[model samples]
Target: MCSVPLPRRALAGLALAAAAPRLTRAAAAATSLRSTEWEMRTPAGIRHRIQLGWPDALPPAGGYPAMLLLDGQTTYPMAQAVAQPPSGQEPPRDLEAALLVGLTYPEDAFDSGLGVDSRTRDYTLPGPSAPPGAGGVEAFLDFIENHLLPELASRFPLNPDRLALFGHSYGGLCALHAFFTRPALFGTTIAASPSIWWQQGVLLKEEQRFVAALPPGTSRRHLLITVGAREQRSEAELAAMEPRRRERAQSSNMVGRAAAMAERLAGLGAGAPQLEFVSFAGEDHGSVISPAMRRALRFALGR
Candidate 1:
C-alpha cells in the first residue's frame, strides 16, 4: 500500500477549506425542517440514532423504495426535499415516496474532533496496518444488516430489492468500503466525493481486488459517483502551493479518483457493477450534496 505523504495531507486540508462554503449564522436560521430521531440497539449492543422522513400516506399496494442515508444530521433534509415528488405530481404516485433513513452516532462521539476518530474506527476494514482503532466497519455493517434493516422492513412497506445507500465524504468512503467488502448488502450505492485518498488509496486497491475475483454473469449492482466542476483547484492556487504538494492533492479530487475507479470497474466486462460518473458544474464539495441527492433519487427511481 502507498503511504500518504505529509505534504499531500496538508494540501488536502487546504483544498477542503478552499472548496467548502462558509456556513453563516443567518443561513442556519433560514433553514427550517424538523427531523425526528429514534434510538435503536445494534446487534453489537451499541445504540445508534436513525432519523426518518416520508410522505404522510403510503403507496396503494406496495411499500416505498427506501434510501439509507449516512450522515443524516447534515444530509437528511436535503435528500428528503429532493426525494419529494415535484408539484403537480401526486403523492406516492410517480416514483413511490421514499423513506429516508439517517444514521448517526451517540452524542459524546463528536467530543473528540468531529467524530473523526470514532468514524475511522467504525468505517474502516480490519487489516494488519489498518491504523490503530480502525476496522469496526464489519461490526457497523452487522448493525445495519442484522438490526436496522429488519426493523425498517417490518414497520414500513419497503421494496427490499430497491434498497439504496447514500454517503458523502467520510461516509462516502464507508459506503465504498462496504461495497468492496460486501457488494450484495445494497442493490444500489451512491458515493459522493468519497475519500479514496483515505489511508493512502487502500479503498481503490480493494476495488481492484474485488473486480479481479468476481464471478461471471453476476448481477450488476449500481454505483453513482459524482464530482464538482470546481473540485480541481485553479492554476493560480496550484501555482501558489508547493509544486510537489499540488500534484498529490490533485490526484485525490473526485473527478480523477472516481473516473479511474469507474473505468477499472468497466474494464471487468460482465462481472462489474453498472457505474456512472457525474460532474456538477459551479458547485464545490459542500454544495454538491443537494444536486447529488437530486440526481441519485432520479437514478434510483429509474426516472
Candidate 2:
C-alpha cells in the first residue's frame, strides 16, 4: 500500500500535544506527594505545623529512632526520602525504621524577622538579651517536652533514647543551644552550618561557660557539625570585621569556630558528646543541606 506523509511541522505539533497531558500528570503526582502536612497544638494554645514521614510498615521489634527536623516546609521531604529504605529493597533485618518529624510555619508567617523570633523564642535559655516579650523557649520546650513527646510516643513506637535533633542555619543554632542548655533534650544533634555568629558570638561564649561550670560526666550528648567548602567567605568576613560590625552581622569565622568547638568538646574527654566535623567540597551554603543531611542520618542511625 502506498501512503502519503504529513508535513514535518504538523507531525511534530501532534506529537507534542499527545505527550503534554502525560507530562502534566507526572508533574501533578510529584506535587501531591510533596504536599503532605500536619498541625499540632502547643500547650500554650498555639498551633504549629508538623510534617511526618513513616515507612510503609512498622518495624517488628524495637521502636524506631525519631528525627526532629526544623524548617519542615523546606527540608522535611529531602530528609524523609533519604531516611527511607531503598526502593524494592527490604529494610535491614537488624535495623529499625526511622521517623522524620518536621516543624513548619504558616505560609505567611515566614519572614526574616520571623526566623529570628522563632529561634530566639524557641531555642535559647532564659537570658536578659532575649527580645522584649520574648524568652519563651522554655514554654516552647514545655510543648515539646510535655505534649509532643507523649503524643508521638502514644502514636508510634519510638525510642526515646534514640531521638536526634536536626537543624540548619538558624535552626542549627537552635540545636546547638539546646545541646548545651538542655543537654538531655536529644541523644544526638546534627548542626549543619550552625550560625555560631548569632548574638556576637554569644553562643560561643555560652559554650565556654558550659564547659567551665559543668562537672565531668554530667550529661551525655553527641554533636555533628557540617559545613560547605564555599562557606569560607562568610568566615573571612567574620575575621576581617571589627568587633562592633562583626557582632552586628553575627559574623564569625565558622570554619575556625567549628574546629575549635570540636577540639574543646574533645578536651572534655569521654564525658562530652562525640563531636564530628564534616566538610563537603564544591558545595556552597545553600547547597550543603542534602549532603549534610545524608551524613547526619548515617551518624544518627549508626549505619
Candidate 3:
C-alpha cells in the first residue's frame, strides 16, 4: 500500500468531486432572483419607492417585456413567483420572461397610518363625491410615463412596445384609468377586481368614451378583467353589515360590473383591445389575488 500510486481515472474523479459544490453554488446564484430598489420624487413632491426585478436569463432581441404593478408591496412578490417559480418548479409553458416593476410608496407610508391615504390619493379619479386626498391618478400615470419608464429603460434592457400594467382593488381602478387615458403606453392591461363603483361608476362612462374614441390605426392592445365570483356580498353578509356599509356594498356590485365592462369591450369587434374576462369561482376580494395572478402572468407574457 505504501508504494501504490492512484490510477489517472481515480485522480480525475477526486478533482471533480472537490469542485462540484462550488460549481453548484455558482449556478444557483446566477439563476436566482435579483432586485434593485430606489426612490423617486415626482413633480408634485410625492416620493415613491420603485423595485425592479428581471429574469437572470438573457433578454430577447429588442429587450424583455416589462410589467408595472401598482400596490407593489402586494403584487410584486406574486409576479416574481411567476417570473421565476420557486426552486424545483417550472413556470407556465406559455409564459415568457419579463421585467417586474413595483410602483410603491416610501416605507414610512407603508408602515404608518398613511397607507390607506396614499393609495386613495394616487389610485382614484376626481369626482363630485371623491374622498379626502383622492384624485391623483393622472399625476401617478404622469410619473410612470414621463419619469419611471424612461429611467428604467435607460438602465435595463426593456422593450417599450411590450409594456403592461397591473393593479388590484383601488390599484385596479388606477389601471383602468390608465388604460382609458393613456392607452398607447401599455400594450397590456389587467385590472383584478377593479373598484368600478368609484366616483359613482365614473369609469363606466370612461369606458364608453374609450370605445367611441378609438382612432383608426391605433396599435393593438390586450386587456384582462377578472373578478371573484363571491365579490358581491351574500344576503347574510349584507344583512350583518352597517347600513351605510351595506349600501356601499350593494352599489359596488364587483362581479356584474366587471362582466359588463368586458362584454362592452368584447363587442367592439376588431378595433378594440383584445379582451378576456374571468370570474374566479368561490373567491372573494382577498382570496382572488393568487389565482388571478396566474392568469395575469399568462395574459401579459404568454406567447
Candidate 4:
C-alpha cells in the first residue's frame, strides 16, 4: 500500500475524513454552551438574578476572558445560542469562547421584570427631569466591580486583563458611564444604541470629562459603538418630534449620532484608546442586538 500512489480524489477524501471530528467538536463546543443561574445581593441589599455562560467542558483552572451583559433576560439567552443562528443571519465565524455573565433583575419575569421604574432608577444619570431613585449608576457599577466580580472570581478563573461590559438602550448608557468613570475595571465596552440623548445629552459632557482626565498618550482599551441604520429618522420625522426634539437636541438619526461619537473619540489623538463604530444597514433599534453582540464579544475575546 505504501508503494502505490492513491488518486488525488482519494487522498482528498481521506484528509476530509480526518478533519471531520475536529469540526464536529468545535461545533459542539460552540453550540453547547453551559450556564448556571445565580442569585446575588447588592451592597444595599437589593437582590439580583444573574446567569453565567461558558463553553462546555472547562478546566478546573482559570484564565479566560469574561463579559457581563445587562438586560440578562434578553441578552443572556441570545448569546448562549450564538452558535446556531437562524437562516440568513450572518454573524462572525469561530467566535472565541469566554465566560458570559448576565446581570438580570431579581424578579421572575425575564422580559421587563426589572420594569420601567426599576430600570430607570438603576441605569440612568441624574437630571432635572429624572424620576425618583434615578442616578444610581454609581452604586450599580460599584456592585459589579466590588461585590459581583469578587463572587465570580471565587467560582471561575477569569482573565482580569480582558473583562468587558455589554449593554443596549438605557443599559448601553449605563455601560458608557462605567467606561468613563471606572475605565480600569474593564478593558472593553460594547454600548449598543446608547441612549445618548438621555437627560439632555449629558453623556457628551461625561465623554469630554473622560477625555480630559486621560494623562496624555495612547491609552490601552477598546470601545465599540453599534447601532441600526433604520433607527435614523428623516427631517420630517424629526419635525414631528419637534418641541421635544428642540428640547433634547438629540438627533433622531441615532446611527449618525453614534458615528459622530466614534469620530469624536477617535479624534482624541494618540492619547486615547482605540474606538470603532459600526452601523448595520436595514436593522432598527431592536434588530441590531445580535450583530452588535457578535462584534462586541469578538472584541472582548481579542479576536
Which portions of model 3 miss their true places by more than 4 Å? 1-33, 86-93, 111-116, 217-219, 239-242
List the candidates ranked by TM-score, beginning with the highest: 3, 4, 1, 2
Every model's TM-score:
0.77, 0.73, 0.84, 0.78
Q: By TM-score, is 2 or 3 better?
A: 3
lDDT of model 2, residue 160:
69
> Against the true structure, candidate 2 has what lDDT?
0.65
Which candidate wins on TM-score?
3
Model 4 RMSD in Å is: 12.0
User: In model 1, what lDDT does residue 273 have?
Assistant: 77
Give all candidates' CA lDDT scores: 0.67, 0.65, 0.78, 0.70
Residue 53 in model 4: lDDT: 65
Error of 1 at 293 (Å): 1.0
Tens digits of per-residue lDDT for model 2, 16-86: 12113222323422322222355667755556676766554433345657888887776787776666554
Question: lDDT value for candidate 4?
Answer: 0.70
Question: Which ranges of candidate 1 are over 4 A from the true structure?
Answer: 1-35, 43-45, 57-62, 85-94, 112-117, 126-131, 215-219, 242-248
Candidate 4: list runs displaced more than 4 Å. 1-33, 57-62, 83-93, 108-116, 215-218, 239-253
Q: Write the per-residue lDDT of candidate 4 for residues 1-303, one digit (tens) a residue.
A: 011111111111121111122224344344432456767777677667878765543322335567888988889888767732433455346665577788887675333334345566677887887656677788888888778776666555566765788999888899888777776777788899998878777888888888877733236788889998877875676677758754443454577768888898888887667788898988888989988887777667644
Pairs that clash in candidate 4: 62-157, 217-271
Candidate 1 C-alpha lDDT tens digits along 204-289 = 67786777687332346788888777777887987898968897767676667877787777676766678888889888889988
What TM value does model 2 have? 0.73
Error of 2 at 30 (Å): 21
Tens digit of lDDT per residue, candidate 3, span 1-303?
A: 011111111111121111122223245336443566778888877889888876655567666688888888889988887776654566556878777899898877653244347878889998998866788899888888888887776555567778889999988899999888776678888999999999889987888887878844333788899999999988999999999999999999999899998898888877867889999999999999989888998899988
How much is the lDDT of residue 51 in candidate 4? Answer: 84
